[model samples]
Target: MHAIHIERHGGPEVMTWSERPDPTPAPGQALVRLGAAGVNFMDVGARSVGAPGWSAPTGLGVEGMGYVTALGDDVEDLSVGDRVAWFYHPGSYAEILAIPATALVRVPDDVPDETAAAIMMQGLTANHFTTETYAVGPGDTAVVHAAAGGVGLLLTQMIKARGGRVIGLVSRAEKAATAEEAGADHVLVSSGAGFEQRVKELTSGEGAHVVYDGGGTATFRSSQLSLRRHGVHAYYGPFMGVPSLPVTDLPNSILLTYPTVQDHVPDREALVTRTAEVFRMVQEGRVVPRIGGRYALSDAARAHRDLESRRTTGKLLLLP
Candidate 1:
C-alpha cells in the first residue's frame, strides 16, 4: 500500500507518497481500509518542527474513517465490513491501518464517509470545549476566534445548539459570511488586537461569558478583554503562538484553561460516549461540518500547504 512518509522535518515538500508493506492486525486490533482522512494544523506542526510523539521517518495523520476488512484475536465485538472511524491513531495517512479496537468507533449509517471522517477530531474537541472546559448555557455570549475555521465552526454550532450566542472573530472580511452561515450571531472582521471594544459593543457593555481563543498571542489579550467578569478563557490555539500569563495580570477575575480533546475521552467508554453525542448532533442536523477542500491521499502535501496558509475555511479531507 502507498502512504505519506517524511524522512526529515521541514516544509510540505518533505512529504512523499511511498509504497509500504500491507499490515496485518494483531491481538485486539482491527484492519481498516481508508475511506478518508481529516487534515489538521497539528499534522503541519508534526511535519515542520515535529511534536513529542511525532518524529522524522514516520507517517503523517491521526484522524480518519474506514471499513474493517479484518479483526484480530479477542476483537469479537466488531466484524468484517463494519464501518468505523477513529480520532487519534498515529500513522493514519496510510491506505490501510491496523488500529487498536479500543480506539475505533462505529460510524452511523446516516453519516457519510467523508463527514464521519471530518467530524471526529474537530467535533470531539468542540464538544470538550463546550461541555467540560466551560459549559455554554442559554443566553450566554461567547467570543470564538477564527470562527470560520474547523474547530471554530464546530464550536459556533455547538454553542448555538445549547442556546448560546456566538460573537465570531475572523481575520479577513471575506470570511465573515462563512462564520455567519455557521450560526455566528455576530462576526467581526479584525485581526490581532482591538476587537475587544467591538465585542463589548455587541454585548451592550456587558462582555461575553466565555472566549474560545485559537488566535494565539496576537489576539490573546483581546480575547480576555472581550470576556465578562468570571468568564472562562479556553485557549486551544497552540498552532499559532503560545502566550505567557501571570495570575496577578488576570483581568476581571476570569478563569483560564488549556483544554485537550484527549481528556474528554480518556478511556474507551468515554470515547464511545462522546462520539455518540457528536453523531447524534449530526443526525439532528444541528452540527453540520463544512468541507473546505478535498485532496487525493497521495496529494496530502498540498492539503498541508493550504492549512498552513490559513486561507482555507472549514475542514479539509484526504480521500483514499
Candidate 2:
C-alpha cells in the first residue's frame, strides 16, 4: 500500500509518500480501498506541532471515503464492495485502510466519493457544534470565524438551514464573498478595526446568541465580545495556535464553553447516527460540501503547504 507518513514532525516537507506492506483487518474491522482523503487542520497540527494521539513516523490522515475490499471475521451487516466514508480513524492517507465497522457509514449512491470524504469530519463537526454544543435556533444570530474555510462554509449553510442568521468573519474581501455565497446573512472582514462593533451592529445591538470560533488565539477575545449575555461560545479548533484564557477572564454576563466533536459526541452509535443525518442533508441538497482544491496523493506535501499558507478555501482533498 502507498501511504503518506511523517517520519518526524516538522513541516509539510516531512510528509513522505512510500510503499508499505498491506494491512490485514483484525476481528470487527474491515479493509477499505481508498478513493479520497480529507486533509484537515488537525492533520496540519499533527505534522507541525506533534499533535496528541499520533506518534512520530505515523500515517497522517484522519478521515476518508472508499470501498470495502474485505471484512474481518466478526464484521457483519457490511459486505465487500460497500461504499463508505469515515472519520476519527488513523492512517487514512493510504491506498487501503483497516477500520472498525462502527467507523464506516455507507455513502448514498448519489453522493460522490470526494464529497463524502470532504464532509465526514467537517460536516460532523458543524453538526455537533450547532446542534449539540450551542443549540442554534430560529431567529438566533451567531458568529462563525474562518467563515470561508472548510467547516466554516458547512457550518454557515447548516445554521441557515436551521433559520439562524449568521455573521461570517473572514480575513479578506474575497472570503467575505465566499461566506455570503455559502448562506451567511452578513459577512464581516476581520482585518480592520471595530470588527467586533460591526458584529454587534449586525445583530441589532443584542450581540450574537452563540459564537462558533475555530481560529484560536487571534480571534478568541473578539469572539467573546461578539456574544450576547449568557450566550454560548463554542471553541472547536485552534488553527491559529491555542488560545490561553483564564476562567475568571470570561464576561460576568456570558457563559464560556469549549467543546470538540470527540468530547461532545463520544458514543460510536451517536456519532454514526448524527453523521448519517448530515449525509442525508447532503444527499437531499440541503447542505453542499464545497471542493476548494484537489491534488493527487503523491502531492500531499504541496497540499499541506497550500492549506497552511491560507491560500485555499472550502475543503481540500487528496485523490488516491
Candidate 3:
C-alpha cells in the first residue's frame, strides 16, 4: 500500500508518497480501506512542530472513513465490510489503516463518504463546545470567531438551534455571508480593532453572553471585551498562537474555560455519545458542513498548502 509518509518536520513538501507493507489487523483492531481522509490543522500543527506522535518516517492523518475489510479477535463492535468512520487513528494518510475497534463509528447509509470524514472531528468538537461546555440556551448572545471555518460554521448553527443569538467575526467579507447563512444573527469583520464595540452595538449595548474565540491570540483580547460582565469565555483553538489572559482582567462574574475533547470524553463510551449527537444533527439537517476542497491522496502536500494558506473554507478532504 502507499501512504503519505513524512520524513521530516517543515513545509507540506515533507509529506511524500511512499510504498509500504499492507497492515493486518491486530487483536481489538480493524483494518480499514480508507475512502477519504479529513485534512485539519491538527495534521498541520503536528507537521509543523514535529509532534512526537508524527515524528519523521510517519504517516500524516488522524481522521478518515472507510470499509472494514477485516476485524481482529475480540472486536465484536463491528464486522468485515461494515462502513465506518473514525477519529484518533494516526497514520490515516494511507490507503488503509489498522485502527482500534473502539475508535470506529458506524457511518449511516444516508451520509456520503466525504461528508462523514469531513464532519467527524469538527462536528464533534462543535457539539461538545456548544452543548456541554457553556450550555448555550435561548436568549443567550454568543460570539463565534473565524465564523465560516469548519468548526465555526457548525458551532454557529448549533448555537442558533439551541435558540442563542450569534455574532460571527470573520476576517473577510465572503466568510461573513457563510456564517450568517449558518444562523449567525450578525456578522462583523475585524479591522484590527473595535470588535468588542461592534458586538455591543449589535446587542444594543448588552454585549454577548458567551464568546467562542477559536481565532486564538489575535482575537483573544477582543473576545473578552465583547462579552458582557459575567459571561462565559470558551477558548478553544490556537490558530493565531496560544494566548492567555489574566483572570483579573475578566471583571464581574465572567467565566473562562479551556475545554478539550480528550478531557471531556475520557474513554470510548464518551466518544460514542458525542459522535451520536453530532451524527443526528447532520442527519436531521440541523448541521451541514461545507466541503471546501478535495485532494487526491498523492497531493497531500498541496492539501496542506491550501489549508495553511487560509484560502479555503469549510472542511477539506483527501480522496484515498
lDDT of 2 by residue, 58-80 (tens): 88988989999999998887999
lDDT by residue (1-320, candidate 1, tens digit) is 99999999999999999999999999999999999999998888888988899978899999999999999999977999999999999989999999999999999999999999999999999999999999999999999988999999999999999999999988889999999999999999987889999989999988999999988898899888888999999988786789997888988999999999999999999999999999999999999999999999999999998988879999999998
**Candidate 2 regions off by >4 Å?**
191-194
User: In candidate 3, which residue ranges exceed 4 Å CA deviation?
Assistant: 191-193
Name the candidate that leads on lDDT: 1
Ranking of models by lDDT: 1, 2, 3
Model 3 TM-score is 0.95
Candidate 2 vs 3: which has more lDDT? 2
State the lDDT at 253 in candidate 2: 74
Error of 3 at 41 (Å): 1.0
lDDT of the structure predicted as candidate 3 = 0.85
- Candidates in order, TM-scores: namely 0.98, 0.96, 0.95
**RMSD of each predicted structure:** 0.9, 1.4, 1.6
Better of 1 and 3 by lDDT: 1
